[model samples]
Each structure stands twice: as C-alpha cells, then as structure tokens.
Target: MKRLYRALLWLFPPGYRLAFGDEMTAVFEALARDRRRRGKAVYLEFLLTESITLIAGAVLEWIEKAAGREYPADVAAARRAETDVSVPAEIIEARQRVTTLVSLMTDAISRYDYKRARFYSLAEERERRRLRALETGQA
Candidate 1:
C-alpha cells in the first residue's frame, strides 16, 4: 500500500520530489490517521484513491512539462508505465483523482516547487564553483 504511494510520488520531477516529499508524506500520514479513527474500510479506500489520484496528477504534470520541452523522466515513467490502462472508464476514474491531486500539485508548483528547484540547482552549482575556487585560491 505504501509502495503505491511511493510509485505515485515517483511522478514528481526529482527537484520537486526533494522539496515536497516529506510534506506530502506528512499530509498522507495525517489523512491516514484520521481515517483510522473512522474505520478500516474507509482507510483502505482513501489509500487507493489518494495513490491513484496523486500518481495521475503527477502524470498530467509530466505531460505538461514534456509539452513545454522539459523532459522530466521520473515523472514520465509514472505515466507511460500504465499506457494500457487508458481506456475511457479508467480514464474517467483517473481524471477524478487527478482533479483533487492536481489542485494541490498545481498550488505547490505555483507556490514553490518549480522555482525552488531551479534556484536550488543554480545555487548548488554556484556553491560547488565557490568551493573549487577556495581550494584553488585563484580564478
């Protein structure tokens, strides 16, 4: 069950994953805890639905990125791996899950995810160069 969650999260681009992995897991854990207080049936349903939705939403964003000329491989795998499951019925269900997860993901992407990744990568490179400079003590 947790593997499903992990598989779904694999859709996030590495940088986005690094930024939001813990936060998303926390949210999932809290949701699971609340459901446990309710019932096993509900908890199971929540797990299945959330896993599907979160993964589907990540797939959508991966498509969006690919369209924008960014090849997000990890994200892409989450989508392509299940190509045969693209029938209309499954798609409709996936779409519903995607709707909820997409809302949160979109919000995160806009708020901090994408920008932070880009900034982090740049800053990391700068730091590495600085370290090298310190070692060399010359341009």
Candidate 2:
C-alpha cells in the first residue's frame, strides 16, 4: 500500500512534485500510520479516500500549471517571501540566510546526518528570532 501511494505521487507534474513531493508523502505516511492503529477496515477506507483525493489533486495541479494560472496567494507568498523586493535589504538578507539554513537542515535529514541537522535546526531558530526582532525594529 505504501509503495502504491508512492507510485501515485508520480501523477503530479514534475515541478509540483519537486516542490512538495516529500512533504506530501510524509503527511500521507503519517496519516496511514495513524489510521492503521484503528483497524484494517478503517485503514483501507483511509487508503482509498486518500488515493482518490491525491489523484484528483494531481490532475488539478497539472491543469493549473498547463493553463499558466497564478499560484494561490499563500503558496505565492511562501515562494515570494524569500525574495520580496519591497522589504528592507536587511530583511531580505535575513530571509535568505534562513532559507539557506533550512535547505541545509533538509539535506542533512535526508542524509541521516542528525548532528548537522540539529545544528542547522538550532541556527534556524536563532535566525527566526533575529528576523522577528528585525521586523519589530528591535534589532
């Protein structure tokens, strides 16, 4: 079932999959794990529902991409927040630093390098705090 779920993820467009595939898979796995604890019938039901929804979502995403539609505001914000030109130079630099740390943390976790992941995680937290301070004119 897990294998099937992973395979279905390929229905999404390559760019969409690249941006969100791991997160979607991790969420589905966690939900599957939780549903499995409820019993076989419930788990099966969850699997069917999730699979159908995922396929539909993938199709819709592909259609949107093919049509060249704008991204939803939240997604656009997330993508744009890193490079928003209207923000101060210091804020943009801080955001870039945080983005780099987050990328490093993700890479470390993927490699099972927990020590480096932990270091990056801590750095991210500190940077986030600093960013908040900057936003509030406290830095």
Candidate 3:
C-alpha cells in the first residue's frame, strides 16, 4: 500500500512533490495505520477516497501550473528570479516557445493525428534551435 501511494505521488508536478512528498507520505501512512485499526472496510474506503482525491489534485495542479497560476504572481516572479535572475527576456521567450511546441506535439500524438504531430514536431525543432541560438547569444 505504501508503494502504491508512492506511485500516486509521482502524478504530482515535480516542484510540488519536492516540496511536500515526504510530509504527505508520512501523513498518509499514519492515517492508513489508524484506519486499519478500525476495520478492513473502513481502511479500504479511506484508501479509495484519498487515492481519487490525490489523482484529481494532481490534475488540478498541472492545469494551474500550465496556466501560470500555480503561485501568486509576486511569489512566482520571485521564484523565477531566484532560479534564473540573469536570464535575458529573449532567451526566456524562446524557451517558452520551445516548451509550447513540445506540448502541442504531445497533444497531437495523443489524439492519433500523425500529420498534426509531425507539423508540431517540426515547429518544435525550429523553436528549439531558436532557443539554443538565443541561449548562446547568437540571436
């Protein structure tokens, strides 16, 4: 059960998992142990409810992150500055373009639209090259 819970934790975004994985796991384990003392049925119900909630929460977190709303604007800006305070605007834009292209390509592939996927793949390659150039100060 602990292993399965750990696997579910992987569904969360990396930053979120890094920030709270151990604490969340510890709490879950303690709750599981307490629930088990009641009965198998009760423990199972708790597990089912928590598992579903975790999955839904992970999806919401990903959506929020993609929408650039995971953190409050001021905090988000501070985090970005801490990570890449010296990164130039052009480089950042280029990187974002590359990331967008990759996401589009993945969506196309998941929908089984090979042609659209190919187009996105080509665009992603071009964007990646642009990003590389910008990073190297050649653009």
lDDT of each: 0.57, 0.75, 0.74
Candidate 2 has its poorest 10 consecutive residues by lDDT at 69-78
- The C-alpha RMSD in Å for every predicted model, in order, reads 19.0, 11.8, 9.0
| Collision count for each candidate, in order | 0, 0, 0
**lDDT per residue as tens, model 1, 1-139:** 5555665675554434545666888788888889988998998889888977887876665556544544465345434533535434444344334433444445555667876546544544454455344434553
Global CA lDDT computed for model 2:
0.75
- Estimate, for each residue in 87-116, the C-alpha lDDT of model 3 and write its tens digit: 887776765666567567667776899999
Winner on lDDT (1 vs 2): 2
lDDT leader = 2
The lDDT, on a scale of 0 to 1, for candidate 3 is 0.74
Cα lDDT of candidate 1 equals 0.57
Q: In model 1, which residue pairs have backbone atoms overlapping below 3 Å?
A: none
Higher-lDDT candidate of 2 and 3: 2
Q: Which scores greater on TM-score, model 2 or model 3?
A: 3
Off by over 4 Å in 2: 70-139
Candidate 1, superposed: residue stretches over 4 Å from native: 1-4, 69-139
Q: State every prediction's TM-score relative to the real structure.
A: 0.44, 0.49, 0.54
